[model samples]
Target: MTSGKKTEKYKLILDAAVKVFAAHGFHKAQVSKIAKEAGVADGTIYLYFKNKEDILICLFKEKLGELVEKFHLSIEQTTNAKDALRRVCEIHYGELEAQVDLAFVTQIELRQSSLELRKEIGKAVKPYIVLIEQLLLQGMEEKLFRQDLDVKLVRQLLFGGLDEVVTSWLIAGRKYSLSAQIEGTINFYLNGIKA
Candidate 1:
């Protein structure tokens, strides 16, 4: 198990990797570049992570893990299923907006990874998928969503829609408020979900 300081170093490395990866793209971003960005030796990077791919997976686990946690916590504060869904989107876009480098790393750099790397990335993303699945289940339970709807498919739709919108925002240089779309996105989701 990693100690507190070790964990800190790990996070520092991931943070640096985001900037390095975003600036250089995944293939062009070397472990040495990331280590330099993190102010650690390239060998030190291997001590904490096996390779560059490990760093990328670690980064996604760190960021997306936080998103899932925050989404769950925020949902706990609300009773209305629709409100819970909206809260999740708000947190999603707000977190991305709060870190442009991370936004670029996730939205742009991540896509440039290889198919195997992409599969690894998807495995790291299970938490977010399961969270959305639970929320859809809850919405159905509360009679706020269509009972006949497939929770899994609906989850794909919701996550896919939000993901595409954010991708568009990132691609467009974020000229508009990403969080500002919360209401409209929620409305679109509810129109499909509402019983």
Candidate 2:
């Protein structure tokens, strides 16, 4: 097959893998299921990924990498630190809402992998966290956030709270709009935690 066909096939396999992994979790998901979902032979997945774990890593790298890049680009257009934070929250939650399957795979199934896999995922996630930390620091510097707050702790609280909110919504079968709560959530964090 041509290179273009190969790339498309790889994406197809990854898309199917995300759905299967989200439905079955990493430990229980099998290559056969992913292949069937992708409408390819079982061996086709091996051609694209070394194994299931490799698929997980690639999925995260692709998805999270895009997310980090988008956040960086989006923040560049905003002048105020508070506005940047708001945009970041909106973008993160919006992306998750837009791709609920991937979100499910990311927020739930990915955590079921091995400790080594978790570490690898953490490496992929570092850039995003660094962006949040930088934003929090800027906010603190500008006196929009609490000056005495630990930048790292505040970053953790911000990302962690958003993550939990998304996870809860996903677990609840997405009954409510995750994006709609952004204003209130951001306000609560900014007011309650900021000096």
Q: Which number leads on TM-score?
A: 1
* Each candidate structure's count of clashing pairs: 0, 0
- Mark the 10 consecutive residues where model 2 has the least summed lDDT: 186-195
TM-score of 1: 0.96
Clashing pairs in 1: none
Backbone collision tally, model 2: 0
* lDDT by residue (tens digit), candidate 1, 35-154: 898998889899899998999998998899888889988999998888888998999889998888888888887688899988999987888988888888888888988999888889
List model 2 lDDT by residue over 65-142, tens digit each.
989888888989999788888888999899999999889988997667789999988888888899889888888788
Q: For candidate 1, what is the total of clashing residue pairs? A: 0
Question: Cα miss at 154, model 2 (Å)?
Answer: 1.2
Which 10 consecutive positions of candidate 1 have the poorest summed lDDT?
A: 1-10
Candidate 1: segments with Cα more than 4 A from true spot? none
